[model samples]
Target: MKLAVLATGNIANKVTQTLVQIKELECYAVASRELSKAQQFKERFGFKKAYGSYEEMVCDPEVELVYITSPHSHHFEHMKLCIEHGKNVICEKAFTVNAAQAREIKSLAQEHKVFVTEAIWTRYMPSRSIINKVLSDGLIGDVKAITANLCYNVCHRNRVSNPTLAGGALLDVGVYCINFALMHLGSDIREIHSTWQKIDTGVDGMNTISIQYNDGRLANLTSAITAKSDRQGIVYGTKGYMVITNINNPSLIRVFDYDDKLIKSVEVPPQISGYEYEFIESVKAIGEGRIESWSMPLTDSIEVMTIMDQIRAQWGLRYPME
Candidate 1:
């Protein structure tokens, strides 16, 4: 697979590096809004070409997959262009600013018969699935509650705090919280009640979301870009509970029982900087002519966006396009 990376930012660099780790894949090119930035990425990564615009990157005939790494606002346009040009894509998370835009782009990909997926690396990891299996086997007994908190002092003015860039702790950090909860608790969210405190940029700096699952389980979730936290998340039940330290990139699942006895402390798979599993799954699926990933299906991605949309609406936060 000849891949054209859509940005030169931190995540873009990670995606490119991850792709390079695969012997079957090649980073054909890298692109950034700034020509110098693109050249720098190409030089560092040894990519074949660099482009100042995403249009040029997508138009490269040698580029089979366009890994979009731009900000939220640019994802829709860039991915749409790639799909239109018959290139499959793996877009950054929070798939789009809204579910409406995400659906449109996905439909376009379907029409073009090109696979498009959200780069939710967590869903594709074997460690994640193993933990899921443990939970599914009732190793934790009847599920009770989920507690997810992700907080790191994003002290700087990041897009997560800027409305123009679809920034917020919810979209930036809390989506993973939501996804984590939904994963163990299932997608049928019974009720959602949330509160937010805005940063200087009019987007949420920190927020707490209370979700009630249809199965009578509760998810108490919180995210913050202005504060520091342990970043641990919990999933509980009548029988036992699973404690995942650092919900976003979990590397441990500690199970405890009703009597507070340690059921097991499972050592997760060794971690990698860029998360190679998701990219590997993308290559395998797309190479097999599959349109959606079985691990994180298109419907689930759409549902995640829908949940975010409603939460943002509740917070009275609107993006540039909205």
Candidate 2:
């Protein structure tokens, strides 16, 4: 699989480092608004080519897959550009600024017969399926509720404070907590109640969201950009509960019995920054002539974005681009 990256940002750098570790994948090209940055990124990552303009990079016939690591506000535009050029895409999370944009991109990808997927890395991790199997096997008995927290002191970052960039703790980190709950608890969100504290820029700085599923399961999730959190996710059940150390990239999973005794512990396999799984899945999907990854389908992406739209509406938050 020949892969090209659309941005030379921090996330793209980390992803490039992981891409080099995969023997089957090649870092073919990288692009940025500035040629110097793209050249630096290319030299550092050993990419075959670099482009100052994204349009030029997407037009390369050899670049089969393009990873859009740009800001959330630019995802829809960048993704549509790649799809229009007959290139598959793996876009970073907060798939777009809103659910409406996500639907448009999905429709475009289907019409062009191009593979496009959200790079919500957790959905493609092997630990996710293992945890699902544990729950299905009744190790934790009947599930009742789930609680997840993902917070970081990243308010100083421009992307987290600028409304034009669709900056917010909800779209950046809260998406992980929501994905954690939805991946394990199911996505039949019946009721949603949320409250948030907004920064002066009108983006959410801290938020508390409660989601009730159709099956009576509830998820309590919290995210913040002003403070640090444990980033833990717990699934409570009739018998006991399971603890996931990190919701973003789960490294350890511990299961406890009714007496709170540790009954099982699973260590995730060694990873190359945990980003390779999603890239590998995308390659496989495209190889099979699929327009979307089964692990993180377009429907799931739209569902998550819809939930975020509802939360933002309740908080009276709207980005400038919207």
Among these predictions, the greatest TM-score belongs to 2
Residue 168 CA displacement from its true place in model 1, Å: 1.0
Question: Model 2, 30-131: lDDT tens per residue?
Answer: 999999999999999889999999989998999999999999999999999999999999999989999999999999999999999999999999898779
RMSD of each predicted structure: 1.4, 0.8
- Give the clashing pairs for model 2: none
Best candidate, lDDT-wise? 2
RMSD of 2: 0.8
Candidate 1 wrongly placed segments (more than 4 Å) = none
Can you write out model 1's per-residue Cα lDDT over 1-322, one digit (the tens) per residue? 8888888887887666667777767878888989999999999888999999888887788888888888887788888889999998888987888899888987897899998888877777666776877778888887788898988787485656777778888888888888888787788888999999888788888999999878788989999899987888887787877888777777788888878799788877775653677777888899899887777777888888898988889988888778
Pairs clashing within candidate 1: 140-240, 144-236, 144-237, 160-167, 160-168
Per-residue lDDT value at 94 in model 1: 79
Residue 175 displacement (Å), model 2: 0.3
The lDDT per prediction is 0.83, 0.93
